[model samples]
Target: MTLYRDQALKALIPHVNDRDIVVAVYQSCFDWLQLNPRDLNYVAVGAMGQASSHGLGLALANPDRRVIVLDGDGSLLMNLGSLVTIANSGVTNLYHFLSANRVYEVNGAHPLPGADQVDFEGFAQSAGYAGSHSFTELDQFTEALPAILTAPGPQFVSMEVMPGDAYPRDYAYIHSAGAREKFRAALTRG
Candidate 1:
């Protein structure tokens, strides 16, 4: 059975800390907000595939901190070039996580093009990532997360998941200047 997105994210909460900068987009943004709301969380709104780029920037700027990017399969497809850019950027603090549901979940769950054929792990590995992993079982994912999160740089993980609990979408919050300001203030204070 495929992992549930919420369950996977829930498993991640204990591993994340204030020092870890998390960049999330679209569905992951909403789910993360609901599950682990924190000032260090950077919600990448109004962008289809920029979370990884943002995380890369954060990782580069704060070389001592860990930057985790929560990205969607559909969104990643839009910015496939980022994999190569990230792998070559020489930043070892960035961890990229792909929630592969094989659909545009936020856009009414439309099936993604090449959904069945895409090999995200292969793409990341080919693009020169230091490490690449795929997890379809929650037990394995949970057991391996600690090591993965602690391992040295530019790691990519593709998680096969399905929709989980429904979350209330706060569009106003995600799209507002207040949200950006809040994140900026928190980041600067850190």
Candidate 2:
């Protein structure tokens, strides 16, 4: 079930805002954020495995924004270069969150390149991400997520979320640049 996804997103609401950034997130997990397009101070690219890189781009673009990259372990393996790039950029406002089920759950949950075989925390630090850790349950994630997100640095946090891909029906999406700008405005002036 997607229950864990909802729980994780709910657990993260206290740390989110228009000034914050979240990229490359799954629409399923993202749908749980309950954000209006008018609140989009960030960008979440489509397709898979681009959250870290996209979040990295936003972090580099606006170092002041608290950039959150909702990554998938499968996706991280797709573009390992992003970790190195983020580390090299020295952007301290980024947090890479990976929901690992050890498979491409979106693409039929098939085994990804490394899937369950890789050590993402080690990978993050070796690539100079500064900090990295893993969580296996919602309670555990909740206890540590805030500290991780607020740590004032770049990190890759992998959580062993329970698996399911039940995305919301008839939800909203930000497809225009103007909409994103308006969202930023709403967030800032409110």
Candidate 3:
């Protein structure tokens, strides 16, 4: 069985404290992270396919802090070139996590082209990421997450996850301009 997205998020949470910035794409990732809310800083990049790039910027700008990219397969496919740039940017604090569920779950469950055949980890390696991993099982994911989060990297972890249940559309509002202002304010307050 594939890892569930919510469980994957839970496994990662313990390792992430308030100082870490989570740049996640779309509703599912944002909503799941909200399950056990804390004063965790997050950016819900409302646009699909933009989380990696946006997270890269934050990682580069804040080299002292860890930046996690909670990306999706469809989003990654849309901006594969960002991987090349990220690999070369020398940002060791960035951890890229792909929720590779194979379908664009938000877009009415549209299956991504070649999603099953794509070697996402290999692509990251080819782009020169210092660490590249793929996990399809929950045990492996749990076992690897701590090290992945703690290790100095431009780490790329591709998780083959099962699609989560539908969330309300209002979940998107968490990253609205006002919310972004609040997120910015929180980061600056630190």
lDDT of each: 0.93, 0.69, 0.82
Candidate 2 lDDT, tens digit per residue, 96-148?
A: 88777677766676887655478888888899887888777778878887788
| lDDT tens readout by residue for model 1, 44-104 | 8776999988889999999989999999999999999999999999999999999999999
* Collision count for each candidate, in order: 0, 1, 0
The list of candidate 3 runs beyond 4 A from truth reads: 38-40
lDDT of 3 by residue, 44-108 (tens): 56566888898899999899899988898888999999999999999999999998888887778
Query: Candidate 2, 126: how far from true, in Å?
Result: 1.1
Give stretches of model 1 more than 4 Å off.
none
Candidate number that wins on TM-score, 1 or 2: 1
lDDT for 119 in candidate 2 is 85
CA lDDT, candidate 3, residue 51: 86
Question: Any idea what lDDT model 1 has?
Answer: 0.93
RMSD of each: 0.8, 3.4, 1.7
For candidate 3, the TM-score is 0.92
TM-score top scorer: 1
The prediction achieving the highest lDDT against the true structure is 1
What order do you get sorting by lDDT, best first? Answer: 1, 3, 2
Could you arrange the candidates by TM-score from highest to lowest? 1, 3, 2
